[model samples]
Target: MPSRILFVHVCIVVFLFSVPLAFGAQSTADVPVTKELREKALKDILGKTKELPKIEKEYVIGHGDYLRVQVYGEGDMAAADISIGGEPRSADAPRQGRGVKVQLDGRISLKHIGDVEAVGLTLTQLADYLKILFATVFDDPVVTVVLEQSNSQRYTVMGKVANPGIFFIDYPITLVQVIARCGGFTEWANSEVTVVRKGAEENKLFKKNIMKFDYDDFLEGKKVERNIFIKSGDYIIVH
Candidate 1:
């Protein structure tokens, strides 16, 4: 009787200790996606600014950027003030300022000035360049350049996701949410994802920001740091 009682007590003790072990072993990564979690992430990413490394204050114009240029004095040469939706105007109609988009080749094509190299130039730099370019055509052309839209802040997502392509980093987004935005993963997708961020210096050789993400902790809604803040030119690979 004593031997049987001791065995029962030992079994109960083992079961009690094993419960914690099992729970501890279960990572939050396997938790299912919840509305609350997504809402929290959405709130966190939106309305946040991701500063570029090194030059945190400056916003350099790059490929796929849209800019608005205004030229004063001697009238609007390129219709700088033309509204989008208005009746078709005659050749003699008043011209207004216009917005220009930076092509994939990092060049901007103005009405008469042709292509202007815009990549790597700030708004001020581009304004000065435009002034010089327009000076030849107009008498003392005072130019102003403003960034209308920034496509240079786009990030690339590839591998395992449904729609893998370049996605604009309109706001600060996390790795996991970005994957969802790309249409989630495929059947053969792996839980691990890799992130590659470009260095700030164009010429200088520097270490790339390479990080890994484990999707398991995310599944259980547990506090995990797998979700990282992404920036422009950052690439995410979900394998």
Candidate 2:
């Protein structure tokens, strides 16, 4: 009877220890897997911004742009008193020229030249071309073209942002500035962001025309250079 009792007690002790050991092993295996997966996901999300190149191309003219055309001595040909499409301007209109809106046909109407093709030309290129065209009416014509308001270049911001819509950008703007202009992130938004660029070349640096950024890491001042300039026709998606 004593031997049987001892054997029973030993078996109970062994079973108790083994049960805890099994649970501990299972917990250890699960914890590391969860941690590793989380880390990998974070790395994948933020790593895509590492190789983005800076965009520094000149602004090209397009439809829906506003232009300020100035002639050295000619006021009638300027954008001051002349509305777009040759419409009459009000007397109280500002003298600084509210600019001529580019028509849907990618052309702007001038006093002497009539409709001039303004799309696909840089500001300087347009200015030089105007000089050539105005040479018929004036001796050694001096002309300057300023991009007053650019309604042509637009970008879309969607997903988890306060204001998700298409926004116009006149100048080169960074990612942070774009987010701020869009009213920042929503309450359920994560720091992960993806940018879908339309004209991005497929190379080792870019994949599937997509780029990612971690707003939290950027806010912490890490990878500041990855806050790339937002291009026209780009879609910014906040996760």
Candidate 3:
């Protein structure tokens, strides 16, 4: 009887220890990723993340932009007689670029050109416009316009971030990078991040495309989902 009782105790101990081992194997097997699941995941990934657009587009000039302006041949007074494009007809390239500021009224006041409309033009286009304006004073003016500072492509970041404010973005930046630029999230910040984009819809008079981005998944370094590019008129809210 004593030997039988000892054997029963040993059996009970073995059974108790084996229970967790058995459940561990079953738990792993419960979520078995079949071929169907893998294909679905692949399809979801392919469908969700479209290729991001190129970052640098031709920037439109707006108010508060510092512009570099240069009138090449005008400095010589007799520019038409001296050079073709601010250089000797036989020379290789042009001269250095100069600058001006777009006032609040969306016009740049140059010495000779005076106030010329610059708000809606690109740097190249502004150069062309300035050339025409300078023609009144100089003979065949060659103008070069370069944007020294831009305030147009800026976005606002608010709510639950360490530092929240408007950020000016020059190059192509992702939403993930935007959060980092705003000093990441606060302790109370959740994964529900919102991006409010303002533009027109195909058939509607006005439209705002609001999207939810998961900063938690973004923090995980997921390559595909974290690549949503920042558009021109985006207001990113972190919560």
Candidate 4:
């Protein structure tokens, strides 16, 4: 009877341990990934996280920008130059001529050429065009264009970040990099970040001029492609 009671106790112990193991396995299996969860997971990734192709990094002219146009060896005609205002020391000195700000109308007035369109053209393209325009005034004019101040290549970050403010960018940067630039997220910051893009054309990657970036998902390697590049005039908000 003693041996039989000992055997029964061992059986009860084995049964108790085995039941929870089986129950746990069954419980975990019961919660299969639901269709809604599957769809949301796919939506979070599709058309969102893919890295964009290498975009041309050339800076284009924009409104409210300051430009310095120099015509070498033409100091007498330097009054026609567009630069920050200063009288040239000599006829041969680099023309520190008057600077012209890009007007709201996207045109700059030259002394002789009048208002010529300066927006939407690169510095090299503008210089070449200016050469043709200045040819009528100077004999073989050497034209050079310099961007004095850039006011358009800027973005803003707001809400739930360590540092949130307008930031200037000279090169293409990713959302992750921009977040890092602004000192990362606050303690209570949400991972769901919204990028409000203004004056941007609708594209396959971004629709309705809005992009939803899941920073946490990206960190988890589930949505690795969500680190999209930041563009000018973009507003990043972390809730």
Using TM-score as the measure, the top candidate is: 2
- Model 4 TM: 0.59
Which residue window of length 10 is worst by lDDT in model 2? Answer: 88-97
> Which stretches of candidate 3 lie above 4 Å from their native place?
1-56, 75-98, 200-208, 219-226
Per-model TM-score, in order, reads 0.53, 0.65, 0.61, 0.59
lDDT-wise, the better of 1 and 3 is 1
lDDT of every predicted structure (CA atoms): 0.72, 0.78, 0.68, 0.76
Q: Write the residue-wise lDDT of candidate 2 on 1-239 in tens digits.
A: 99999999999999999999999986763353454686667668769666533435668998877788878877536433534344325322222225776778999888788889999999988988998999998987778888876677888888998877787775679988988887899999999988889768753334788888899999899877768888888888999
lDDT of 4 by residue, 90-153 (tens): 3223332246667789987776778889899999889889989999988777788887766557
Q: Which digits, one per residue and each the tens of the lDDT, describe model 3 over residues 9-121?
A: 99999999999999998686448567588666776776756543333557899866667677774442211221222432321122222345566788877675457788988
Off by over 4 Å in 4: 1-57, 75-100, 109-115, 198-202
Kindly give the stretch of ten consecutive residues in candidate 1 with the minimal lDDT sum: 88-97
Best by lDDT: 2
* lDDT (Cα, tens digit) per residue for candidate 1, span 33-150: 6758865676677635643234245678987666787786454333333344453253223222236667778888776687888899989888888889888888767787887666
In lDDT terms, how accurate is model 4?
Answer: 0.76
Candidate no. 1 TM-score = 0.53
